[model samples]
Target: MSRTFDDTRRWVRFGTDLMLRSVGGLDDDAFAASSALPGWSRAHVAAHVAANAEALSNLVHWAATGEPTPMYASPERRAADIEQGRALPSGELTAWLRRSADALEAGMTALGEERWSARVVTAQGRTVPATEIPWLRSREVCVHAVDLATGATLADLPPDFLTALCDDAVAKRATAPGPALTLRAPTAVWELPGDGEPAVVTGELHDIAAYLTGRPAAPLTVDGAPAPALGAWL
Candidate 1:
């Protein structure tokens, strides 16, 4: 089923709420602790998420005003912003996260129905409608909450969100060179890369989502063999 803007908005709220809860109790030292994502601390993940909300709000503004506002001045600037913000005290970082999320939602709500259809470019250079912004935010908040490593897990995500994530992950992996693989979850089956004799990977929906998104794959199993290493997927 196609997702409506309302559906995406609800998911975005849920995901962001979860993210806030995940990091709410972190102290400054805890924020500096390594996150599940390799080489990134909890602070880094939190900074990236906050900056992402602002970057996406820029798209909403572009759509609303018909101005060409890029998400960042440049990739270097984007990295620099994250580095600058990542060292903030835990309380300030948390406040920044909340404010950025609220600002993005307000920017979206301010758009007229017609404005929602206006084309906008993502940081990745893909052109999409303004309606896509919520889905993009949903993906970031939900997945990164787990990366925060503050007791959140893939299973904590909403089922429908996990399904949507699997679909998106498969689509992104379609053009990458990899062995054809079938991801089997209780709720759905996805064919990855769509060619050749497919290797079967079995897991719960959350496990598959984690594995496909470059997270740990310990919970997933290949059909009577070791799971093949997947190549880089963003």
Candidate 2:
């Protein structure tokens, strides 16, 4: 089923709520512990997610007011912000994340339909309509919640959200120079960068999404072989 704008909006809300719950449950020690990502702690993950919300909020404001607002001042500054966020006290970090997320939600909700059509630039330099803001945030919160290593997993995500995530991952790989692979999910089929005789990988939908998104994936096979190693999802 194709997701509507409203569906994406609800997904943002749901994903954010789940992330908050997972982050909130972490004690100071747990928050300092390493996360799923190598070399980054849970604090780093939370900080990046929080910083992302504020960055996306800049896009929403640009769309609403017709002002040119870039997602971040610069790549270096963005990285620095996340790095700095890691040092924040646990209480302050959580409050920063919650407050920024709330501000973004409010900004998006207040935007008119016409404003939603305004074009904005992503941090990656891609130009897209403001309508993409929710989906962008949805992917961030949902995926990062699992990255927090607070017991949230791909299983907690909605099927539609997983499908959308897979669709996005596959689409991204298709446009770039990557290995040729065919992903067969229970409900859908996706062809990654390849011409012919691609490795056919079969798995449950969430597993496929996890593998594509650089998360821990369940058992999957590539042409009856072990799962192929994938580059970072970007």
Candidate 3:
């Protein structure tokens, strides 16, 4: 089933709440521990999630006002902002995360129906309507919740979201020139873009999505062998 804008907005809120709940109890030492993402601490993941809300809110502003507000000033600045956010006190960081997410949602709610069709560019340079903003944020909070290396897992995601995420990840992967592959889940199968004979990967839907997005996933196999290495999703 396709998701309406309202559906995606609800998902943005739901995912953010879940992420907050997952991280609410972390202390300084817990925040300093390594996350599922290599070389990133739970602090880093929290900071990035907070920064992303602010960045994506820029797109909402641009759509509403017909101004050109890029998600970030530049790649270097984005990285630096995350670093700065990472150093914030845990209390301050969580507060920022909550505030930014609320502000983004308010801005989105204030946008007129017509304004939703206004074009904006993602950090990845893809030009899309403002309607995509909610989905973008949804992916960040939901996936990063798991990246926190907390008890949250992909299976905890809504069934619809898992499918959409898998499809989106596979389509994005297909955009670049790379090896061809096939992803098989119990209920669905996706063909990754590239040349040559596709390496067939088989797993549960959520695990396949996790594998595609570079998250820690349950065991999966490629052509009866261990899953091959993959580059970062974004």
Candidate 4:
């Protein structure tokens, strides 16, 4: 079933709330402690979460005002902002993030659930209806929350979220060829058809996510393929 804006809002809220409560209680030093996502402290990952929200908010304004929106004025600027912001002291950084999240959610909800049908330009330069906003928002919040690894395992994700993520990954991976990758779940498997010579892997959904999003996983093969590259696109 296609998820509605309300559905999206519900899932997004659930995911972000879970993440904040799960990790928000960490002390200042603990906030800087390591978790998933190589080389990025928890603070770093949190910064990206908030920064992206604000960036998307700006796009919402562009959509409402008829201003042209580009994915990134330039990738470099986007990267620079994250790199700098991620280093702020834990207390200040976390507060900034909470502020960003509140503002973003308030702004989005202000548009009214019915308003998502209005056209908005995407970061990718595609013009899609506002209905897509929640999907995009869900992706960033849910996946990145996992990236943060806040002591929460993939098992904590709701069923619909996991299924939706894996299914969407399958469709998006169809045309792209790279390293052969396989996603094995406790109950089922998702096979990605890599370039001409398909590569394969087998692991649980969380394992699949871990590998795709630059986290470590079991001995999944990558023979003549860089299957993990596809994760970057999402």
lDDT, candidate 1, residue 212?
A: 85
Q: lDDT scores for all predictions?
A: 0.89, 0.89, 0.87, 0.69
lDDT of 2 at 82: 95
How would you encode candidate 2's per-residue C-alpha lDDT over 80-191 as one tens digit per residue? 9998998898998999999999999999989998999999999999999999999999999999998988898888899999998988888887776667888898898888
Report the C-alpha displacement of residue 189, candidate 4, in angstroms. 5.6
* Local error of candidate 4 at residue 172 (angstroms): 2.7
Clashing pairs in 2: none
Choose 1 or 4, whichever is better by TM-score: 1
Clashing pairs in 3: none
Clashes of each: 0, 0, 0, 7
Writing each residue's lDDT as its tens digit, candidate 3 over 1-234 gives 366678788789889999999889788788888999889999899999999999999999999999999999999999999999888888888898899988998998899999999999999899999999999999999999988988899989987888889888888888877778788988888888787777888999888988888877764565468776777687
Per-residue lDDT tens digits of candidate 1, residues 87-175?
A: 99999999999999999989888889999999999988999998899999999999999999999899988898899888888899988
Clashing pairs in 1: none
Cα deviation of 60 in candidate 2 (Å)? Answer: 0.5
Reference-based lDDT, residue 21, model 3: 95
Please write out the lDDT profile of model 4 over residues 1-234, one tens digit for every residue.
Answer: 345567778878977787677667766687678758778888778888777778777766655555655546677888887887777877777787788778878878787545556687776677888767777778777777776767666657766676676666676666565655566666566777765554566566776655554456563554533344554545
Which regions of candidate 2 deviate over 4 angstroms? none
Q: TM per model?
A: 0.96, 0.96, 0.94, 0.79
Query: Which regions of candidate 4 are displaced past 4 Å?
Result: 69-72, 179-191, 196-203, 209-214, 219-233
- Compared with the true structure, model 1 gives a TM-score of 0.96
